[model samples]
Target: MPAIGTLVDSFDDNAVDAVLWVDSYGTYSETGGRARVACTDGYSAYASAAAYTLAGSSIYVRVYPPAAGGAATAAYGQVSLLSAVAGTELGVQVNAVSGVLRCQSNVGYWDAAAVEVAYDPVAHAYVRVSEAAGSLVWATSPDGSVWTTRRTLATPGWVTSSTTVQVRLEAHRDSGTADYAEFDNVNTLPASPSGYAARKAGLFLGFF
Candidate 1:
């Protein structure tokens, strides 16, 4: 079968149960219809759920970061694809501290062995990621149509050979200060034809 699965959450449901899992400091009620992750204690916050099992080797999503505000500290919110419940994940994010977009990877809790600085994708930008043909591509767009590739992870370990991973939303704060982020219109839609070269990938599996 071709690689095809869609999980689009407009977050209009106004319920966190719409997702498979709402773990650690992640909530869906604070903003009515968006998934919100807040980490005021200067810790990593995660909001995730099963997205889709890879039928080939391609997956991606378009996410909206929270609008600028709140404590004005160095923080970030991201959308990622995780291979396991607790370890190994890859995705694109925006760092408020550095004022730029980035490609991030995590091996375990509090263990970010890799962090690649990309371009600045100011608040509300359409950020996306796609993996196929042994590569993981990260890009950002002012609009969903025109995109600029920021970074590419070609290493084998960047994305495991395994075909299933969960979609995740994260909020990270620098110091023990109040910071929050909201995600909306999250989906598994490849950035472009070239991004998902091996297969046509785009789908909205379900809210939950």
Candidate 2:
């Protein structure tokens, strides 16, 4: 198997790393080797890292979603790739109540596709977004070794042209008692030699 690259955090220190994350909202902390985000009624909790260029790289996170049966009508945990411009992002979210997994993109407008498979802590735990040659791929995994591609999109010009993009982890609940989501094994993989060649080849392929 290929080695995982560019570890962002394992949360083993029991503290959020300020050097690696910023622009946090609500409660975010490291607990028992996981990054935990507090999900309260009417509010969202999140943190972001704006350290990587979008091309030729991939970002991943393992999410343990919150359970259902609460007063909350809407609750979910998400991992997102955000362009430098606000309101432009690609994200995957797992619904807490229905366990639905939604993959969405926003480049001035929101478009989404969903997977009917409910999230299982052991069987469906990972989400990833990869960029190569002006395209973005979204996928999910059970153990990070095998991945299921969920969506593929032409990279928005705002993203492909940006010098850097952000990776965000977020959790939210609406009109309910407080709950939380756990995030772990945050990491990134740099582009390989073949990926660079693909990018070069894409120059002549014409985007959608």
Candidate 3:
């Protein structure tokens, strides 16, 4: 189990905190209280947090649509829970080009389990992945208050067997133009009586 208090970054410091994350690729920085990733054409970028146990915990991030300098043919923002072992991961992403939100799990490939719907920036701004008691859940929220479950599945062997997992933020673009994505309120909360609801309540109350 992790500590009682949640780990969070509002990105107000104008710098990616090295203590909280490892910049994995591309250009990442903090500006105006949000983590920003600049992705060049036909490229991707991401950052990962320090490893931590996921059992009985929830990880989430607020993702904004990609902002492009020109006609955007393809772009998206994603949040993921990743195991150290290859091919073990779960993620949720909002596609700027397709205008859809998707949740997927990977065993060896990304098709293990998946779900998607038309994306609504207001209603699906926040994406979350949680683990509890042997099950994994994917959900989305507008204001990080009310949540709608997207998918749920039995905990994968790789995840159940791992000691810790990392949370990742990713941005990708396939267009001819460069673009960027913004993320905020990257949070990992421990188990609570009310679970996600409790966390949201605390967020509104400034208790997180």
Angstrom error at residue 205, model 1: 37
* Predictions in order: lDDT: 0.57, 0.71, 0.73
Task: List TM-score per model, in order.
Answer: 0.66, 0.79, 0.80
Tens-place lDDT per residue, model 1, 21-114, is 5554533343666667774545444444444544334334444444444435556777767775476766677766666566665567333544
Tens digits of lDDT, candidate 3, 180-204: 8888877732234597897888898
Clashing pairs in 1: 6-203, 6-204, 6-205, 7-204, 7-205, 18-207, 18-208
Give the TM-score (vs. native) of candidate 1. 0.66
What is candidate 1's CA lDDT for residue 178? 63
Alpha-carbon deviation at 51 in model 2, angstroms: 3.5
Ranking by TM-score: 3, 2, 1
Kindly list the per-residue Cα lDDT of model 2 for residues 1-208, writing each as its tens digit.
Answer: 1122353776777878886677667787888878888776644445655656666667788888766537446688888777776777778888887668877787563664433466666666888877789887888888776888888888767655665567678887774667788888887322345777878778757664
Best by TM-score: 3
Best by lDDT: 3
Worst 10 residues of 3 by lDDT: 1-10
Task: Show pairs that collide, candidate 2.
Answer: none
**Candidates 2 and 3, the one with greater TM-score:** 3
Give lDDT: candidate 1, residue 48: 48
Candidate 2: regions farther than 4 A off: 1-7, 44-46, 69-72, 112-117, 188-208
Any runs in candidate 1 off by more than 4 Å, and if so which?
A: 1-5, 22-32, 42-46, 54-73, 85-87, 106-124, 155-160, 188-208
- lDDT of residue 154 for candidate 3: 88
